[model samples]
Target: MSERIKKELALYKLREIEIDDMKLKVEELKIGEQLGAMNYEEKVQSSMNCKNNDYVMNEIETLEKRIRFNEIANKRIDNALKRLDIDEAEIVRRVFIEKKSITLTAQELFKSRKSIKKSIDRAFEKLKLA
Candidate 1:
């Protein structure tokens, strides 16, 4: 179960990158459209631009679908965390969601490293049962 949670966290991070890339592509397409409008051969260039815009629009739609799926997956993770006790949930959130190291989490939470590790281990045990 802990492994599954880790995998899901990794997937969530990858999806975030994918979504950012998609947004960048959309911006690039907009720039391309502006350049196409400035072309001296207006008729031919405009026709090509229209086709390109249609393709870009379709790609954006597909990207949006993937982003929505990822968002749903993240929401499910949040809901699962809610099932854990507050301290356990905080440990899980710091280590997994915030992507912090055990030492960093302990420092941030003002707890000893051993205590943090114990909380994390207990959190995983509860998450497994959950």
Candidate 2:
């Protein structure tokens, strides 16, 4: 692989790792939020004046951190794509980031699905060769 493409691939891989980390963090945040809700319900039911303010604050902080992490990761990917001069970031964003079907992406881009597939393949090949 060309050094340039290798570098881009490495950036892409790093971004993927960050994304996976964010996904896990999101799941954890969801669980924490659910627990916080349940705690609020319990406090209400008991009428003991138990305060879950701290719990709510902690969950909010965690959620904010996760959002920040995701934002940074996204920016990194954007910069990497730009550095590679792939000029196909939109295609990648639609097909991969948006999880759109190949056919849908092709229709949206006004290109044949086969052509889009071929382009994607060539991009990867070039990346590898770089």
Clashes of each: 0, 3
In model 2, the runs with Cα more than 4 Å from the true position are 1-51, 84-87, 125-130
Looking at model 2, report the run of 10 residues with the lowest lDDT sum. Answer: 46-55
lDDT of 2 by residue, 81-117 (tens): 5633353656665665566788998999898998877
TM-score of each: 0.71, 0.47
Clash list (residue pairs), candidate 2: 1-130, 2-129, 2-130
TM-score, model 2 to reference: 0.47
lDDT: worst 10-residue window of model 1: 37-46
Q: Give the true-structure RMSD of model 2.
A: 8.6
- How well is each residue in 1-130 modelled by candidate 1, as lDDT tens digits? 6789778865766767777787787777667767665455553465765577668668767777876887788788788788888988888887887789999998988999999989888877877787
